[model samples]
Target: MKTQIFYFSSTGNSLCVARDIGNAIGGEVELIAIPGALKAPRPVTASAIGIVFPVYMWGLPALVRRFVEQLQIPASTYVFAVATCGGNAAGTLAQLRTLLEKKGILLALGEVIRMPGNYTPMYGAESERSQKKRFAKEKIAIRRIAPLIADRKAGKVDCGTWLGRRLLSGFVYNGGMKQVPASDVKFRSTEPCNGCGLCVKVCPVGNIVLVEGHPRWQHHCEQCMACLQWCPQVAIEFGGRTQGRRRYHHPECSASDFVW
Candidate 1:
């Protein structure tokens, strides 16, 4: 059976899981990237269709949610999703399941894999030892999920807390979405910036543009923090908040992996 996995990853955690799952399924696996310019639902027909992405604000990222809303899939196609989060997936899987159901898509499987935390605005990157431990856990989770996906088994990952899922998560996620449009104004490059354009390229939303030598932020930011986290010279900062904090991307993920 043909399998295709669509993914959006700022760091590399989601991409890594998608690739691993694809390898294990052993068919023609197409790993497609969800870019920033997603404006329409596209048709997808395969024996199996999967989406792997991170959990943001206890729910789906706005772009990913938009992608799901517009996606067109065959009724019989086996559908699954995997959400990667640093902590509490909260309502992510539940939200996705509800959204897919609205489109008559039966999401057969929902899984969550915890990876090293990457939300630097809240905390610095985990220590190397801690990250190593989490990566090991991620590997085992992928192994367990692959066979189920290969078998087209049906199940879901449960989101916790009635209050969190029904009320709190929706509020926070919606507020985050509202803030997304103008969030780019908070990002600025430091004096260390050398016009390498790494930030411009790392941004999935194409929100960064190079003016003369340095990078400039456009108003439509996803706040994925890829550009800030992956800057080679540690030049990008979100206001004064991220100045001295550590940056993180999946250890196994490189800039090349993000190329289309």
Candidate 2:
């Protein structure tokens, strides 16, 4: 049975889980990039389909929400969704399940993998070390869940409560709907930016553009943090706020790790 994995990742955490599942099952993986970015074609025949992404504002990221609305999944394909979150999965899985059902697909499994939270706007650099420790712990836990995902097991995970959903949805839509405030979306340059333009090339939302050999965010960002997290020189910063912040990418994933 052919299985396909589709994912959306900003800091590469979701991509990490997707890659591990792909490796474990030895099935095809497709990345559902943010809108207006390159993407791969959906497979015509697959016994199982997987959707992986990080939770934003206790729900799906805006880019992933748009992608799910536009996605065309086959019927009765044994669909599954995996979410990576700093806390609980919240209502993200329920949201995906509803969206897929609207498209005539059944979500067979929904799993949330706890990972280090990277929302720099809400959480600052003070917790950087603790976040890394949580990430390490999550990685260890992922090993146990990987097998269940590979076997298409549908586990009864918590979906949070009505109030929790309302609160998260409100925060995400009102506070995180667009580019984070300038004070929040800070970036600075170190000595390592070689003007490679890789950051510009890999941005799914065209948030970063090169200016005089340095990359600058033109605002209108999705807060994916791909540039800062994926920069090779580690030169990018969000003002001085993110200085000394730990960059995170998927363990075995890179910019080219997922496409479309």
Candidate 3:
């Protein structure tokens, strides 16, 4: 059966998981980038459609949320969603199911993969040793769950219990979104920036634009961190707050890499 993997990633954690699943299944991987970005629609007729993304502020990333609301999926397609999170996925899976079901699509399965915490303000800098441990755990979890999705398993995918949802929602949305100081969201640039414009080219939301030979964020960012994380020269930084911070992306992925 033909399968397509769709995803939106910031720090590349979600992208890594999406790529691994696509490689394991030997399926075509498609990127469901944000609106106004370069992307090809998934051919969903009689095929398996997989969505992999990160949970932001207890919900989908603003861009991913908009993408799903506007997405037109085939009625007969088999749908599955996988979320990568530092801790909890919040209500992402349930929200995705509700949206897709309205379009007459059925959710076959859902999985959550844990990765290094990238929400800098909230999680801080996890040690390389800790990140290694988390990645190893996630690899095992992905292996266990990958086959279940490939087999087309049908069952209620439990992300967590009701209490878990409530707690996670409070932490991700209230603690991370509402309460986090704006100063924490600031970013910086390093000397490596050659002003190549790749960040502008790859930004799905047009959040970054080249200004005077350097990329400048116009305040109305989705906080997807795509520009900061995907800079080819490692030039983008989160201002003084993230200065000297360790940058991360998927091991084999790069700034100009396109999944589809």
Candidate 4:
């Protein structure tokens, strides 16, 4: 199948998942960055289309929802989604299914893979040993999902029960999500920042720009934590809460991995 995987990532987990699946699916699988794809919007025509991204606030990131809304998929395409999260995927997969449904396209598959959590506002990074364990498990999970996608398998979307989904996602969906576009307001660079300009480079949305050698947010942030996690000096902080939090990104990925 001519598979095209459109993905969005902040700290690299979702991108790594997309890469593994694209490699395992055994075809011409093209990994496309969602931000870059949005730059030139067009009707997407492919035998298989995969939307891979990190789950935020128990649901899709606001930018991702917009991306899906703008997507134009052919009727016969096998559409799938893989949501990577540190916790339960909750209603994230179901949310994608609903969005696709609105477009008259049935989401053929939805899967969630748990990776190391990087939302420092809520917690610190896990132990290095624990993170390694997650990386191993992530590979195994992707291995299993690749074949199902290759076969165009469709069953129950993997979202949790309706009650759990509503209870978990609804709590913050209205309040927190509405603030996502402006959530960059919480980010600030500490004294350790040296104007390396790396944050500006890693931001997938081009939300960060150099301002007199300091990074400034444009309020269109996705909160992907790329700048926070990938900053070499441990400088970026989220609402002053992430000052001491350990930064993390997919071990297999680097600052230069955004080619797609």
Candidate 5:
């Protein structure tokens, strides 16, 4: 079946997973970057459709949620979703199922793949040992998931309590989403900034601009941390927390891979 995979990734973790799945499941696998697709979501008539993105605050990213909400999926198309996360997925799949149901799309598959954590505002990158462990697990999970997707498997998997999902969705996830728009203001470029304007180009939301040859945020941030994580000189910081912390991008993905 022809497959169209829609993916959003800041540090390239989700992007790598999407590509791996496409490679395994033979066909005309089209990988569409969610940020670019969000600009003009046209109807998709693929034999199968997939959405892959990172879990944010135990739920979907604000932009990812909106993209699914607005996406036009044909009723007959088989649909699946994969949530790549550092920790528990909580209600991410449940949240996505609800959104897709509203559009008359039954989510045929919902699963999570654990990956190294990159929520730098909260913590530093994982240690090399920890990351290696996670990546190994991720590869196994993808290998199993890709065939299921290729065969059009229908299933759902969720690992969280009803009460826990409610609390996280209502408090943590929702509150975290509110912070996304203003969070860009917290980003600061240190002395290492070279006016290269890479941040402006790397931002998925077009939220960064050059002011006096340094990057300035437009307050419409998605909190993906692309600009900060991909900065060549290790210059970008989120408030006082990320100045000296290690940055991480999926080792399997490169800057050119993210340009889509």
Candidate 6:
């Protein structure tokens, strides 16, 4: 059976999960970057489809939600999802189930995978020692999750702690969503930026461009922080909060791994 894994990752946590799942499924599999996928319209169908992405503000990333809404998927396809997050899954999978339900499609398996996080607004990047522990556990999770997906399991997948957090998550998530587009206004590069234009290249939404030897954010930002996390010179910062703090990208993933 053919499998198409559609993923969105700012720092590669979700990409790592998507890649692992693909390898474990062990058949014809292709990984598609969600941002790049949205650019060129085409028919997308497979025996199975996986939606793997990070949850933001306890919900779906802006672009990932749009992809789920617009993707041309068939009702019969075995649809599975893995939401990679720092702590809580919190109705993120439920939100996905709702979207698929609207199209008369079923989300066969929805699982949450915890990983090292990179949301700078909330805190500093995690330590290398801590990230290694998470990676080890993540491997074990993929080992267990792959067969269920391969066997085409059908049901809602949730962490025991996730159920209670949804009410609060939903409230904060909805309110936070409104600020996503203009949130980029808070990001500015420091003197270290030398017009490398790498930020422009790494921005998932193409929300950045170079003007006078510096990267500028357009209002359509996904708040993925790709430019900041991937910047080689460490020049990018979010409203001064990220200054002199660590940046994180999955150790297993590189700047070239993402398509856009």
Per-model TM values vs. the true structure? 0.94, 0.78, 0.80, 0.94, 0.96, 0.95
Alpha carbon lDDT of each predicted model: 0.84, 0.68, 0.68, 0.85, 0.85, 0.86
Worst 10 residues of 1 by lDDT: 36-45
Give me candidate 6's TM-score against the actual structure.
0.95
Pick out the ten consecutive residues of candidate 2 with the lowest summed lDDT: 31-40
- Output the number of the lDDT-best candidate: 6
RMSD of each: 1.7, 3.8, 3.7, 1.6, 1.4, 1.5
TM-score of 2: 0.78
Superposition-based RMSD of candidate 4 using all C-alpha atoms, in angstroms: 1.6
Count backbone clashes in candidate 4: 0
165-239 per-residue lDDT for model 4 (tens digits)? 787776767578888878888888888889999999888788888998999999988887888888889888888
- Per-residue CA lDDT of candidate 1, range 94-193, in tens? 8998898888888898998999878787888989999999989988988888889998898756666788787757777777778876878888888999
The TM-score obtained by model 1 is 0.94
Q: Per-residue lDDT of 178-217 in model 2, one digit per residue for the tens?
A: 5553432466667888998777866666677788998887
The alpha-carbon deviation from the true structure for residue 221 of candidate 6, after best TM-score superposition, in angstroms, is 0.8
User: Residue 5 CA error for candidate 2 (Å)?
Assistant: 0.4
170 in model 2: Cα distance from truth in Å? 4.0
Residue 208, model 6, lDDT: 90
